[model samples]
Target: MPQELEIKLTLEPAPADDAYRWLSSLPETSVGPTKRLANTYFDTPDASLNRLKAALRIRKAGDRYIQTLKTQGEFVAGAHRRLEWEWPLPSAVLDRDLLLATSLVDSVSLDELKPVFETNFERRILMLDDGKAVIECAFDRGEIVSGGQSVPLCEVEFELKSGQEDRLLYWASKLGEQVSFFINLISKAEQGYFLAGVHRPASLSAGAEPVSKLFHGLSRLWLTGELPQEYVEAVAELKAKETKTDWRTEIELFERLMAEPSSAKVSDLGKAQLALLRTGVADE
Candidate 1:
């Protein structure tokens, strides 16, 4: 019943300090000290847990450790909404009983479980609220280690604690005015799986063709409220298909609002994008 509603975006062409400062400078934001977190993700022999769209991990926060289970949920309005369960552990070891308590009870077997990958990062957090919306903004910087290979991890996550999804998008649009970022749908767990040569997210398949690939990239910019020329061309192709009722009409409006982000209201495009978050049409 506990769901995590969060959106992640990568800061591009902007220094880490700049992103930090920008979030700090925002109104009604309370800053917290940065904390280094080390997380180890686990899976079973055949990766049955991954197949179930669930990730199990034990996190080390200073002297404290936590075990968490998260399901890869649907994307609504460009934010990932997933069911999550967390418990404080006495140490860094995974608790078998806790794993059995989650929705993944039937799929989890303690004996076969093994460590897959790890994500170690330093997180700087801030709470942003203006009575209407409360967002836990986390700017994480560090690296994800796997198979003797690691990728630098730096991204900001805006998790909607409570309030309308539009409110979270509004603050993101305002943040985009000063910094350049791309919406990233991939979660840390998914990234590690791909990095570990264990699993590939379904989103990567969107790039199999030219048009879908373009649209996939375009979707990543939904929060920025800035429409690129390339994206306009991509949407044109997507709009060409006639697969679902009202889908065409929706894309038409998206095409118009996406044409000029400056003149058009950000909320309009945001709403349009959210409408298409789950494409109603498939190419003929």
Candidate 2:
């Protein structure tokens, strides 16, 4: 069982090209080949798989098609930890027998799985080696399409290949400074479901339980750069809770976020948001 560890961030839409240029100019990184990835995510119309906190996708990178299943995992600050399984397929279709081989054999009805959305993007990977750590920084730019609705998918992922998360966080913060970005907690599959239909159920929070609502609110504010009503309500909920030494950490962080001046830098605010999110994981 290989669990993935990475920090996924969404680049500001307008400067996506600038992000690519900046990545190419990095003196410390070894730029790797670029590949266009077309990934189709599947699940029953009722989103039974999503409810189970898993995602299924068949990716077409060049001529090869790979089936991937990612189980429910953890997310904190800007980092993700998830159990992932991948298998090669003959073409772009799901292999029932192979899927059943996994632990979710009984959780999902194999026959009902259908394509709900697709993510077609170009990925530019850069290898960073600083003697102590090796990281793969991938810049992804594309669109997530489902039915007639589509949303832009512009993200940068810092995946730890041979080092500590401390290194990963350092790189994540560096990228946030160079490019206008926000920590992305929503998976592409979840975003697809959201675009497919609002009536459908979604498990979009990358945050764990308890402070899931706060995570949701903060994620929205970071992605869109606007504090919505939902965020206000989420903060209010946190404020209403008693501040115990242990559980009040999130509440205090939320307060700190609110106390931040309107003149704060974008990158600093982003870092603060991540700090607040990290507390949620600590509690878990």
Candidate 3:
């Protein structure tokens, strides 16, 4: 429920391959069916600012669903560490609301731990739909409450199917690994957004640039209650172009503009200004 670490790791290039060998390599010991999932995301130009997103995710083990109003963040790019937190209330799909937090640690690349976590053995027969396999190793850091209630104390997951959970363990075990990392929902979603380097608006302090103030400053001339007409127009146009835009690039531009000495970073102001440009037209 509070702030915590959420991370992900995506294969540099994803590959879809056969499951027979990996499955056969498993011990007779049994486990339930584990589905393969692919998610495609759609977002407005200010997705990072709004902390909002829409996506279509399908898993081989279940039906596809529409995911709306999702939020994501990135700690850095490609050094293979990321974080994410999401609310269960799907803005458009399903019923009820859930809260989750998670992170992914690409232990494979840690130089300090490399003596045990590194791997070099290659396989050419693996069936990767695109010649790349992604492994999303995640962790959830929650707290344990009293009264015998075992709340999620944060969870870590290894989300690669190219190898069975057992095979993954083999590699990890060889490296003297002792931590328990299971695959789960919170971790998976975290991985998806981390791979994309999602943005987050800077949290301003008292006497600093408040987000609301930024919006007010930018929309001064077109001021209106709640949302100015210009702001509404910008949101509408942004929504229309969301599916086709490169959200990350736009996020960078927004961050740059707002960081300028005399710039305004208000929500309405950002919308209105972006609406007049070709870039932010898709930013809702």
Candidate 4:
């Protein structure tokens, strides 16, 4: 079981080429060979896997196919940590025996799985070695196809190959100076689901169990100045059923913070709100 620690930044399709050029020009960057990746995502008709915040995909590179299962974990302030398991496949098809060996064995059956969407992308990778840390920066450009409709995929990702997570963030900030990008919380798999008109289940949990997770997830979106409508609705629904006064107050403050206009830079007020959420008190 390997943990992937990375940050994904979304960019406009038009500026993606220039951003790649700038990335390749960095003196400390070591360029890796580019490859085209074709991936097919699978799930049950009702999306039993997505409701669990898990993704199942088989990626084809040349004649080699690899199956991957990724379970969602903590994501905060542009950083993501997730559980990932990958296995080499003899062919492009899903291996039922192998699938049964993992965590998804009981939740979904082999006969129920079907291809819902696909993503095709050309990836250009760059490695930055600053003596103490190694960061692999990947620029992916392509489109996600579902039901004959396509959505452009233009984003840059920084994965910590080795070293502290702070080093990854430092380089991400430095690259931000050259490219205008937004910290994207949505993953390619999630985008595909959205394109397929599959909505997220409102049943996050039955009771107060979902509060902490919602708080952290929404707080990260606030920090990045992103307020997706689904997130807004989720918080509203959660707050309505919450029993704890302190947690309900936190949710209300978060809503108020999101309602206010956000500046180009991370606002002082936004920082204050995040601090308050973390410490249960506003910083002086």
Candidate 5:
């Protein structure tokens, strides 16, 4: 059971091209050969795996096919951690014994699984090693196809091979200064699901009603250790508009919590305060 820790950033084609050039110029980066990957996602007709927050896919890299199963894990800011299991395949067929070894075996039948969407992308990888930490940076450019519909994919990812999670954010921020990029909470699988008409992507921006967004944004900032300035302003404006005095106290408590180390566990008081803040958002 390998846990993947990475930060995903969504970029436009022009920005992606600029970022690629910038990354290639860095002396410390070791660039790997570009490879084309074709991935097909599978699920039962009613999408039992999707409902369970699990994903199954087989990726074809040249002449080799690899099968993978990933279960959704915690996501903070742009950092995503997921439990992944992978195996090499002799052909494009699913391995029944391998499927039976996992939790999905009980819930899904191997025969019922079918391809729902496909992602074809060309990936260029770059590596940075500082003795203690190794980060693999990937630039993916391609399209996701499903039901005769397709969406272009242009993004950069920083995957922590062995290092502190903060290092990934540090490099992301450094590169972000040269090129504009936004954190993408949705994964490629989620995007494919949305395009397949299963469900909509989760909202990332604060809308006209800012209370709920403020609370959610603050929660992510506290958990991920990456706070966007817009979220801070939104929280301030929402507090000013409200007459409740307790909301101000709750905001202050959250600010203090945000300043703590990422390894710090949330105290009982903090949990209660968070619950109160969520209740306030719901009441609004």
Candidate 6:
């Protein structure tokens, strides 16, 4: 196995919306949905750079956990390797699987179906909303292989595409968190908030106010085929709830704008909104 070589750049949150627009406007690349991934990551409490662990995962209607051990050094040129091992566990939890992976990083190869892997350096981020909320962002460069063939070419991801990206980017900027991408480091659960259970306001309510309400607005636009009062009212309601002028309102407003008819102006707005949405989801 060769170590994966990559770089991560922190994206400034203030320009994240514009950054998203920039990314979308570029020629489309080898990215988007065709494969599925759910990884369990682990780390030590001290937050040292190298003390990280992870469990690469496979889901066959159920779940399979492959333990992987990884160590990071300065980014190097050539084929970098991620060592992996298949482990037997009493019960499979991502954290426990991550521990096992730490020991097996040398055994797994990039070419096998039992496990699919990719190689690319990418960006990750920790986002906050007005100093009150947090989410993780990962943009990966790699491939998914099963049985020695390509399944899906991995692209940069803006995950948790349920909320508005513009808002989160704004929030990250206002919170003074550096928004640039990071060097490629393979620690999945850096904050451990996802496992500890981050709140899911969007998943719960069709009408309930989302702390990040942009996804709902998009859903409405996509489903109705036309923007309605619901879209505008949702923005107002969210704005009032914002109580403070942050990215939250901006996101809702952008999402509303995305729902407009796909005219030339609307197309540009949609493209811009898509960038914010993509960036926001990645941070999650």
Scored by lDDT, model 5 comes in at: 0.71
lDDT of 5 by residue, 169-213 (tens): 667766765676655556788778878987543334444344434
Please list the residue runs of candidate 6 whose C-alpha ends up more than 4 Å from where it truly belongs after superposition: 1-137, 141-207, 219-233, 239-284
- Model 2 TM: 0.79
lDDT of each: 0.71, 0.71, 0.28, 0.70, 0.71, 0.34
Model 6, 1-284: lDDT tens digits are: 43433222223343444444444343422223232344433332332212233334422212444444445332121111244445544343433434333444354332221222322233333222223322233443333332344322222233222343344344323222322332112223321222233211122135444322343334334333455454466456544552322445336445546454443132333333444433433233
The alpha-carbon root-mean-square deviation between model 6 and the true structure, to one decimal in Å, is: 15.8
Put down candidate 1 lDDT per residue, 1-284, tens digits, no spaces: 79988877765425456867987887789897789999999998788888888899999988999999999876554567789999999998788887766677776667788899999999989999878989998999898999899988888899999988767667766666566665566678877887887875544243343243334445434433455555665576666655544656557665665655455443344344444543534333
C-alpha TM-score for every candidate: 0.75, 0.79, 0.24, 0.75, 0.72, 0.28
Error of 1 at 134 (Å): 1.0
lDDT of 3 by residue, 106-169 (tens): 2111122101010111122211221233333322232322222322233323334443323333
Which of the two candidates, 3 or 6, achieves a greater lDDT against the reference? 6
**RMSD (Cα, Å) of model 2:** 4.9
Tell me the tens digit of each residue's lDDT in model 2 across 7-86. 87766656567766776677778889899999999988788888887899999999989999997587654577899999
TM-score (C-alpha, index-matched) for candidate 1: 0.75
> For residues 179-259, could you state the per-residue lDDT of candidate 4 as single tens digits?
566555668887788778774323223332333334434434533346544455556665565342354444555566457
lDDT of 6: 0.34
Model 1 RMSD vs true structure: 7.7
Q: For candidate 4, what is the total of clashing residue pairs?
A: 0
RMSD to the hidden true structure, all candidates: 7.7, 4.9, 20.7, 6.6, 10.9, 15.8
Error of 1 at 2 (Å): 0.5
